[model samples]
Target: MIGVDTNVLVRYLAQDDEAQSPVASKIIDGFTPDAPGFISQVALVETVWVLTRSYKMTRDAVADTIETLLRARELVVEGAESGYLALASYRATKADFSDALIAHGGRLAGCRETVTFDKGAASAAGMRLLGAD
Candidate 1:
């Protein structure tokens, strides 16, 4: 499987860049389930950040888009089981997608709980608060 970058997904999803969108679309369109494009965890997180922070997409929209990507026949998301767990956490709480992913990955690696300083992560993403009582 060929690895895809976040830029390619952004270009395709945004369709904002005149020159690159078509190129990105062409590459994505060429993908098949038998030889699908691979999206790594890093790219997935970056894509969510860009779609939300940079493009001003709503959190719900970003969640929907990510869920759609995870289900795409022409794409393969790395660590898909953990990714889905993160997605579920994202839906059920106000945690950031990246934070949810971190917690999920930690769980998969046999961590009892992830520790973090971020309040949202600690409260919403199942991480233990690292400071204060």
Candidate 2:
């Protein structure tokens, strides 16, 4: 499987860069289950950040995008089950997808609870509040 970078995914999803979009689409569309494209956990998180922060996509839009990526049969998403859990958290709460992904990763690794100072993460990302009273 070939590893896909965040830029490639951003180009395919955003289609904002005319020069790169076609190439990205070609690569993505050419993948098959026999030789699926690999998307890393890091690339997935960065793609979410780019779509939301730089492209100004809404939270629901970002969640939908993530769902599309996760569901693509030609794409092998690393940490996908945890990624799905993160997507669910992103859709159902105010927690950042990145934070939810981090917490989910911790949970999959057998963490009892992830501790954090961010109230949004604690309340919405399934993490424990480190200091909030």
Give the residue spans of candidate 2 off by over 4 A.
none
Best by TM-score: 1
Local accuracy of candidate 1 as per-residue lDDT tens digits, 1-133: 8899999999999999999999999999899999899999999999999998999998889999999999999999999888999998888899899999999999999999899989889999989988767
TM values, all candidates: 0.95, 0.95
Give per-residue CA lDDT, model 2, range 19-102, as digits (tens): 999999999989998999999999999999999999999998999999999999999999999999999989999999999999
Q: What's model 1's lDDT at 113?
A: 89
Q: Where is model 1 more than 4 Å wrong at Cα?
A: none
lDDT of 1 at 15: 93
Range of the 10 consecutive residues with the lowest summed lDDT in candidate 1: 124-133
lDDT assessment of candidate 1:
0.93
